[model samples]
Target: MKVGFVSLGCCKNLVDSEQIMGVLRENGHEIVGDPRQADAIVINTCGFIQPAKEESINTIFEMSQYASKLIVTGCLAQRYEETLRSEIPEIDAVIPIRDYGELAEKLQEVLKDAGNGSFSKSERALSGNPWSAYVKISDGCSNRCTYCAIPLIRGNQTSKLLSEVREEIEALAEHGVQEVTLIAQDTTKYGLDNYGRLMLADLIREVDRIEGIRWIRILYMYPDEITEEVLQAMKESSKVLPYFDIPMQHASNRLLKLMNRRGTKEDVLALVSRIREMFPEATLRTTAIVGFPTETEEEFQELLDFVKEVRWDRFGAFTYSREEDTPAWSMSPEVDEQTAQRRLDQLMQVQEQISLESNQKKIGQVVEVLVEEREALTGRYRGRSRADAPDEADGQVIFTSPREIEPGTFVNVRIDEARPYDVAGVLAE
Candidate 1:
């Protein structure tokens, strides 16, 4: 049977989608790219907030047109099993996330003629660019932030044992993966539930030992948990890129406290200073949430001022989503949708200038780029530098060369031009 899989939301959820496809393939199902050609279609969804949940629902309905059997899994299924089953009459099955291990059995029950075959549990049949992959170090979130429903959705942090992670990395390395992005709900809190202390620094040290892995990137690190030890580990390792992806959320200490985030405004400032002092060349990326409950004009100004002063190399912004069951859901003085969106827009405008400055500085500098693709028409090679993560949400370097280079090969590109989110140049000797 041809099964087309639709992966939605964050990279973490994408990993789950990969595993589902892997199990299905092992159970004698053909994985097809086009939904129209599928006997069944499975959607691995994201129910993180309003926007993501809407996307998941829309995707399910869209696939229903093509698939004879429509299966919904991941966060949306886990969160709204009853609602989806009742409202969406076309949905054949709604497989909850917790029962992912039993995916093969579930499919066999619904896809009768598709046959009965057990999951091999060997390895994931990865999707997307073969040259890049995301290695999820842990599952779930321990930090119960006031406005977040992650703890309610994914439960507590469960760190994969160091040996297990290393084993997975080994498999990925053998699969021709050149770059791996370490991801989790709270990556810095990894091993706290199991090892009783932060093990991210040591984990990097271990993963860096893998032979075929060229670039190692880490993301979703909680602020106030990015230890000096982690920095030291990154600095010492040749493979570990000095790229910090710290999601501070907001700049006002008062707003942060209300949001139930760790660290004060001064603490964040100090941490950023320390990081820049230690690794000046490091690519610092961050994400923020604007228009939290009761956020004053002064507070919004504070955030804008901080962004201008700090000048983050890469930045992303999202408006606060008033999710149900969260502490802030019923909180007073909720910022209206229009106001929240305006704040997000204003914040990003500031970031655009900062990004332009950061990229302009890269002009005339030679950086190592992991070749990702070659444009058949333009004959230009495109790839990522240390600043870019495997997620592709970040920037890339598009360079031209007389010699032929493979997708996974690393080449030095001398940057001569810059864009807000990309750079261009010629391949170096």
Candidate 2:
């Protein structure tokens, strides 16, 4: 059978979809790109926020028109299995997210109505960029942040074995992966569940020893858990870029405490200061929620001030989405959509200026950028520096090379111009 797969949300979820695709291929099933040509459609969804849920629902509906069999999996399926079955008449099956060890067999069981087929076993296929891929170190969330539905959807934290992680990355390196971004519910919490201690730093040191990997970036690190030893490990590894993706949702002590975040205001400030103290040119990226329940202008201002002080190289801000079953859902003084959007705009406006200034500072400095693709029309190459991830959501460096260059080639580019979010440059000899 020709199966079509559509995955949505963060890289962690994407990794799951990749593994599912691998299973489909191993089972002698054809994985088609176009939905119209497939016998069945599989949707690996995200229901992390309100918008994500809407997208997932809409996607299922859209795919349902032509799909005789539609299988819904991932967070949304786990969260709303009964709701989907009752409301969506077209869905054939719903598989909750769980250990996918023998998922090929499971897929056959799900496809019992469609008739069984040959099943083989293999690991996740490399569906993402050839040069870069997301290596999920763990699954689920233990930090029950009040506003987040991750714990409810994905359950508590579970770390993969250190050897398994190493083997995965080693296989990825062998499969032409040059850059690997380690992802988890909380990357800093890796090995904490089963090992009874933090082994993230140790894991990094081990992955850094792998031969073929050029860049290893870790994401979703909790601010307080990032010890000096971790930073030191990052500093020592040539392959490990100094990019800290700390998701400090809010900077106000009151809001943070109310949200059940681990760190205090002082701890956050100290954490940033310490990171900069250790790695002066380290790229700092963070995420924040603008308006939570009962969030006053004073608290917003505190967060704004903190952002200015931290001068994050890349910043992402989202308006608070009041999710169901989360602790904050029933909290009084719910922030209205208008207020939330305004706060979000104000925060992003400040970040725009900060980003421009940050880029301007890089003018004339040669930076190594991994060429991702080239414009056929203009012969311009688009790529990302160490500061940018594979998605290039933060920004990209566009350069015109004297000669044609292939994607995945690392070239030094001298920064010639700066925009609010991107940089224009020329290849440096």
Candidate 3:
């Protein structure tokens, strides 16, 4: 069978899609780059919030026209199976996320007469963008924030075996993947439920020893779980990039409790200060939720003030989603959509100025950049520095080059100009 896959949402979703592709190819099925030429189309989706859900739905609808059989999978299907089936009659099958292991067998049965899904997994190479990859050390969320529905959808946190993560990293390195981002609902919470200790530092130390992997990044770290030891490991390990993606929802103690988030505003600020003191050049990224239930104007000001003081290198703001079955859904003083959006806008505007200033500091400085691609019309190469992640985070380093630089190759770039979200540079070699 000739099959195509469209992965949507987070890096975690992409990992799932890669596994499915790996299995399908092992069964001897042909994987096509073009969706229109495939026998079936599989869409891995994300249903975290209202915006993501809408985008996933639209993507499924668009792919339906190109493939004969449409399979809906991932968080959205797991969360709203019946709703999706009823709303989108074009889909032939709906596979929940947890049951991904059965995909190869299901494809065989579905396309038996067509001889499309009969390949073995070992024959197919582990696939996806080779420059960067996402390694999910664990699945699900243990933190039951009042506003978040991840725990409800993904269940309690379950850490993968230490050996399994090491093996996966070895496999990714063998496939020419240079940078791997360690992801989980809460990365700092890894190994707590199963191993009875926070083992991210140990696990990362092992992955750092693997050859062909240059940069290691950790995401979704809860503030309370970020210990001094974790900071020390990041500083000491040559492979570990000094990138922290801590999601501090708000900067007000009252609002923090109302949102069911652990730690006070002071605790968050102190952690930020401590991280900066330890790794001055470290790039800190955070996600903030605005207009949560009962968030007052003064509390919003407090958050704005924190942003101004800390000057996070990267930041994103999202309006509180009144998700069903979540504690914050029924809370009083429910902020209207307009107010939430306004607060989000105000927060981003302030951060934009801070980002501009931060990027400007890189001007005329020499930094290591990983060349990802080149644009023909622009006559420049596009790449990312250590401070920048693949997407979501900031990306820069477009400069004129006499020679082409291959993806995944590291080169020194001298920053000549900087913008709010990108920087211009020339190859230092």
Candidate 4:
């Protein structure tokens, strides 16, 4: 049957959708871009935050008009399955990630029961606008942060075997996928539960060996668990990008404890220093949560000062959102919505200045940028350098070349102009 898959939220969810797509293709199913053309529609959703949750629901409702069979899967459905079924009448069925194995069979059953139309599921080409693809190394979270509901939805931590993950990377590389971002709830915690210790370094080294894969980036690393071996692997691997995404939710030790985040302010700073010392050109990316429940003005300022002190190359900060079943959901002294928003704004304003300064330093230098695609608005092409990731992080290169550039090809671009979040350049001749 013709199946349309809508992948939502983070890269982890996209990996789930891609795996399901793989299964569908193996079963000779056709994947369609438009829901109207497809026999069924599958929505892989996010339940991480209020905005994401609402977006997922709206997407399902919109697709329901033409889709005869609507399958809602991924985090949102996994966490709130019954609520979704009761509220959304257009949804034919809700399948969580655990039950994704039934996808092809369910599609057949749904299409067969609707006797009005004939259905045939034939494998089609992989269609996406993505310049880079993500590979999930693990599922679920053992960290259980007070503001996160991931563990409740995804269950216990489960790391994919080293060999299996390498195989997946090879498959992606074989399909002409050049940049593969490694994703998980907490990447540093990968393989600890199953392998008796961490093995992220090993897994990444193996992936780096795969031919045709040029850029390897890792994301969602916890502050406390990044080992020396991992740092060494990143430094030595030619394919591994010199980028680190360490999530330190709060800077104050007291606030960190409340959020169930490991490491003190000193610990985090030390790690950052160590990373910078090892890879001088490394671009550090991090996320922080402001205005958590019981957070004081003094504590918030501590975080702001930390940001200034660290001067992270790229970073994002958000106001804490109360999530159900999480430890901090019922905590007293909840910061007012307005107050939370204000803190978030103030923090970002500071980070913006730091980011601009960092970008300014790149001017007049030639950096390797993976040419993603030609921009529709400017008629010039857009892509990212080693310092930038695909979306949340900044993209560096806006270059004009005499020759047409493919999406996965990497070329050196000279930085001519710099902005807070992006850079403009011309391809180096």
Clashes of each: 0, 0, 9, 4
The reply for model 3, stretches above 4 Å from the true place, is 113-128
Query: Can you give the TM-score per candidate against the true fold?
Result: 0.96, 0.96, 0.95, 0.93
lDDT per residue, candidate 1, 1-429, as tens digits?
899999999999988888888878777789999988999998999999999999998998889999889989999898889999999999999998777667777877887645343333447888988878898899889897998888887889999999989988888889888888899998998899999999998898999899899888899888789998988888889888888898889889998999889998788788889988988888888888988899988999999999998788888889999899999999988899899999999988888888888899999999999998999999999998888886646888999999999888889999999898899999999
Error of 2 at 48 (Å): 0.6
lDDT of 3 by residue, 120-159 (tens): 2222234555768888888888888998878878899999
Best by lDDT: 2
Q: Tens digits of per-residue lDDT for model 4 on 48-88?
A: 98889989989998998877888888898888889988988
RMSD, model 3, all Cα superposed? 2.4
What is the Cα-based lDDT of residue 111 in candidate 3? 54
Pairs clashing in candidate 3? 1-116, 26-119, 26-120, 26-121, 27-118, 27-119, 27-120, 28-119, 28-120
**The 10-residue segment with the lowest total lDDT in model 4:** 115-124
Q: How would you encode candidate 2's per-residue C-alpha lDDT over 1-429 as one tens digit per residue? A: 888999999888998888788777766778888999988999999999999999999999999986678989889998998999898988888888863554555577766533222212256767767878898999999998999999998989999999888998899888889999999999999999989999998998999999999999999999989998898899899899999999999999999999999988789788888888988888899999988999999999999999999899999989988898988999989888899999999999999999999999999999999999999898999999999977645899999899888899899999999999999899998
Clashes of 4: 4
Cand. 4 TM to true fold: 0.93
Q: Quote the positional error of residue 207 for candidate 2 in Å.
A: 0.5
TM-score of 1: 0.96
